[model samples]
Target: MTAPYLIIFDVDGTLIDSQAHIVASMEAAFSGLDLPAPSRAQTLSIVGLSLPVAMLRLAPDHSAEMRADLVEGYKAAFQSLRLSADGAALSPLFEGAMSVLETLQADPRFVLAIATGKSRRGMEHILDQHGLRPYFASVQVADDHPSKPHPAMVKACLFECDVPAARAVVIGDTTYDVEMAKAAGAQAIGVSWGYHSVEDLRQSGADPILRRFGELPAALERIWSLT
Candidate 1:
């Protein structure tokens, strides 16, 4: 049998549509500090980064202390929103996401994994909510690794799964994901439905950019076929 290929997915913008909660929590965090919130685009642009790094980029003019406070505030606000009565609606899986995951889960040639900037608790909540905990053979979160574009998270996931970078692919909706995968010597596939633009994904070296979730399986096959 061929060695099982590792397919590492990024969580927030890629698999889960958490934009509603993400933007609202960012606004609430800024409001709590009497600071103006970042615009929706600005907030979304930093979606794949760790909270601290995201705050720095979004609120660059603010003091480190202020940014630190924003980090805590955002975490609290996001958790609150997650536990709200309509939380499930605030972060639904993208259309066709579940079906594709199910398909991949049944494929013996692939081993699924997660690499994301979300905290372990936050990622866990999402997994539990969507019954996705079993879909991933390995999970790497921001709590344990440096932020994206650093390659640590992807490298860690590859390590834990005992899969070589050449036999793995990273799928996400952001330039950070593309860069991270490239830095780790893994191929990257970008999803257009996520926060980042398709042009950005292309510029960052993602090939076979997927226009929708349904196209993923074919894209994966195409990628591996060329290797």
Candidate 2:
């Protein structure tokens, strides 16, 4: 019998296309303080980091107090956007994402989990919004772990799912995800449809960089076959 392999995913850029909401909320947060907003590029670049860390990077010259305020502003703005009628459009699933997840979830050889930088509340909202709550075996969020590029989240998922690091794969759109999975002693697969470029993902040590969500099954097969 084949051993069960765990597939851990990153949410923001991997499964959900939330860039519009993210950029708008970031702009609103800065505007609330009369500060110059980060460019769309600037904001998207920090998508895989925790809110506090992201604010620190974007506003390095500001005092800690100011950064804290920006975090609150951003949270408020994001929550408001999430509750609005247009929320579905604000953060829809990427193309082929639903079908791919469904297929994976039905496979007995694999287990699915999520490790994301989203707050617990935000992660729950996304899960419920996309009917994804039941699909994941374990869900690690920023509320309980350090930001990405750290192995803490991935380690927790492995522990919960009872999967060895060698048999686990982290699929994400950012270099942060690649680094995190590597730090956790797991394989990393990059996705091209996210915030970071494919070259960046490759340089950061991700293998079998997938061009579409549908390509995941073969990527997983390639990674796990080596182990």
Candidate 3:
């Protein structure tokens, strides 16, 4: 029998279109703390980072104590937006994302998984909303692992899926994702319709930046060939 291939996805910019909601949450956090909110582009630039690191990047002049406070504030504000009384999901899966996920999950040779900067609770909200929980066999979240650009999340997913680094792929939108994947000796693939630009993904060492969800299967086949 052929060994299994682990196809790991990132949550925020990769699967779900949460950029607007994320910007709103960051703005709310800054406003509550009487701090100036970073511009949308600046906020988007730090999308894949953990809250503390993201806070520092957005407000580099602030002290660690204040940055920590911002983290808590962002969490509370984001949580409020995520769990409104009406129970509507803030972030919707991008076009064709669901179909791509379903196709990948149904493929017997592959094991679908997630490696993301979202907290476990946040990740749960996304998966539950999209009914994606059953498709993933392994999940690594910011709550359990260090922020991206670190190989820990990738390593954990490979370990959990019982797949070697050479047999796994990290599909995401940010440079942090590319760096993290390569750090673990895994293939890094980027999507163009994400927060970061295709140029950024290339500069970060991503091999092929897919332009659409429909291209995912072919991207997978090509990437697997290289491995």
Candidate 4:
């Protein structure tokens, strides 16, 4: 029998194009708190971080209580948006995302999972909306683990899926994701369509950054072969 391999995806920038909804919700959160909203670049800079971590980075001078309030504000704003017709359309799967997911899930050699900075409720909502819940065997989120670059999420996925680091891979769009994969001793593949630059991903130790979703299979094969 062939050895099993695990492919872990990052939700925000990797599978879902959620930046618009995220940024809008963040702005609303700040507005609700009567605080200044960070610029798009500043907000996107901390895309893969946990809510509190992201908020703290964006407003370092803000007190811990302020950060907690911002977190709740952002969640409320995002939830409100999700109820709207326009916000209901938030996070469409990226081009070719469904294609790759379908193909991989149907293959016997691969076990799929998600490690994301999203709250479990939010992650479940998106997965259910996209009809993607059945595809992933494990779903790791900030509600249960630390933020990206901490390796906790990836380690949890590996443990749940019974996949060794050598046979596990993380595909994401940020430097945080790359660092997490490295810390977990798993191969990292960076997708270019997301927030971070290719140079940043490379600097974070991603090998052969994927320029498009269609390249994912080849990238995985190359990663496995080179190992």
- Count the clashes in each prediction: 0, 0, 0, 0
Write one digit per residue (lDDT tens) for candidate 2, span 1-227.
Answer: 65689999999999999999999999999999999999999999999999999999999999999999999999999999999999889999999999999999998898999999999999999999999988999999998999889999999999998889989999999999999999999999999999999999999999989999999988787766733
After superposition, which runs of candidate 3 have C-alpha atoms over 4 Å from their true positions?
A: 85-89
RMSD per model, one decimal? 1.3, 1.4, 1.6, 1.4
Model 1: residue 46 alpha-carbon error in angstroms: 0.4
lDDT of 1 by residue, 35-126 (tens): 98999999999999999999999999999999999999999999999989998999999999999999999988899999999999999999
TM-score (all chains, Cα) for each model: 0.98, 0.98, 0.96, 0.97
Clashes by residue pair, model 1: none
lDDT of 4 by residue, 21-85 (tens): 99999999999889989999998889999999999899899899999999999999898888789
Cα shift from native, residue 64, model 3 (Å)? 1.2
Alpha-carbon local distance difference test for all models: 0.94, 0.95, 0.90, 0.91
lDDT, candidate 4, equals 0.91
As a whole number from 0 to 100, the lDDT of residue 24 in candidate 4 is 95
For 4-24, candidate 3 gives per-residue lDDT tens digits of 999999988999999878998
> CA lDDT of 170 in candidate 3?
95
Task: Give residue 140's lDDT in candidate 2 (0 to 100).
Answer: 97
User: Lowest summed-lDDT stretch of 10 residues in model 2?
Assistant: 218-227
Model 3 superposed RMSD (Cα): 1.6
